[model samples]
Target: MSLQPDQAIEVFYSYAHEDEKVRDKLEKHLTLLRREGVITEWHDRKIGAGKEWQNEIDTHLNSSQIILLLVSANFIASDYCWDVEVKRAMERHETKEARVIPIILDFVDWESAPFGRLQALPEGGRAVKKWGNRDAAFLSVAQGIRIVAKELAVSS
Candidate 1:
């Protein structure tokens, strides 16, 4: 299943609420990508209200063409993040309906990540050492998002 140009490439961002700083930076990158016409819409908890969090998440997940997993310690610790987002992304992978891009923001057991076999952005393990600088890390992540956006655009 391919996306339509006018459909707005929906990206479902999965991350732990505890990593608010990382998530905020990612949202900013997504907003920048939108302004550049790289993507039409981006969805994340940062824009949703507490009253309908679950519903809002489901809406984006179902409509998304890709899933960006912000792998972090707290993300792996959250059951909802693991069970719902990870599981759904796995299903999407199985059907080849959506692409799952893991962006390692913090130390996570890559060997045990939901889909560690899939190639990840910013690399993993020792490569994370370079991400110690916040600005550099965000820039690397933004580059990864651009790659995904290009792939989606071409595939569509």
Candidate 2:
């Protein structure tokens, strides 16, 4: 069931606007995967002009094989991120349709969050902001994503 070399996995990023800086840093770290053509990422920022944002977000959220949640204080407070995106991602994960990876971006008490049952990135669920080197933190997250992508490819 291994995917072909040309196969590409779709990845969706769900984050709060307030954490855009960390999200951008994470996306930058993922550039290697994009360059290698193993994964294509989509976020709200990718929505084209005049496009129905909700529809666009829904389409990507449903179709992406992997969903990354940039968890933080703001992300946890956002109804849309928690109620809509994370909920849907959890559903897909339950059905084995996708893998959900929560990328903790800032110091936040998320142990009680719905996605808390799942494993988080940056290892040990440590917030990226707490890392001595943000770049190193992002690199760790990207490497975890690479492993997940490879596993999904094999399963597919």
Candidate 3:
């Protein structure tokens, strides 16, 4: 997992619009890693106005070293999330081209989903929405991500 001084991992967030608030909180938790230059992350919300959104998403998704799938009922229901983002993410994951991490954001029937077998964040696969303290859940997820980001380091 060691990397050169110039190397850093790029992270991509694949989430549903319904979960934007949760995603924002999680992104905050990940700030330390970004500050330390361990990783740089992107999501649809980062797309600028007037830009071709799909092209921006595809470029980021294709290049990121770590892909976080923010799983929830809404995420599972989104056609774009399932049919496009998840499809390509999994393809990259299967080929060892990128690492896919399923982040449980809410309770849903997802054990049979494409990312079912991958170990999920906030240990025990407990959904963030179900946690007694939501911040604690995000902290757990961030810590897990830190570990993986370190292990998955790549050339910038």
- Judged by lDDT, which candidate is best? 2
Model 2 Cα lDDT, one tens digit per residue, 11-109: 999999998887888889998888887788899999999999999999999999999999988999999999999999999999999999999888898
Please state the error at residue 105 of candidate 1 in Å. 1.0
**Full-model lDDT for every candidate:** 0.73, 0.90, 0.89
Candidate 1 regions exceeding 4 Å error are 1-7, 40-51, 123-130
Q: Candidate 3 on 105-154: residue-level lDDT in tens?
A: 98899999988999998888999989999999988998998898887763
RMSD of 3: 2.3
- On TM-score, the leading prediction is 2
Better of 2 and 3 by TM-score: 2
In order of appearance, the predictions have TM-scores of 0.82, 0.95, 0.93
Return the lDDT, model 3, position 101: 92
lDDT score of model 1?
0.73
Which 10-residue span in candidate 3 carries the lowest summed lDDT? 1-10
Question: After superposing candidate 2, which stretches have Cα over 4 Å from the reference?
Answer: 1-6
Model 1 per-residue lDDT tens digits across residues 78-117: 8998999899988988898888888777766765666788
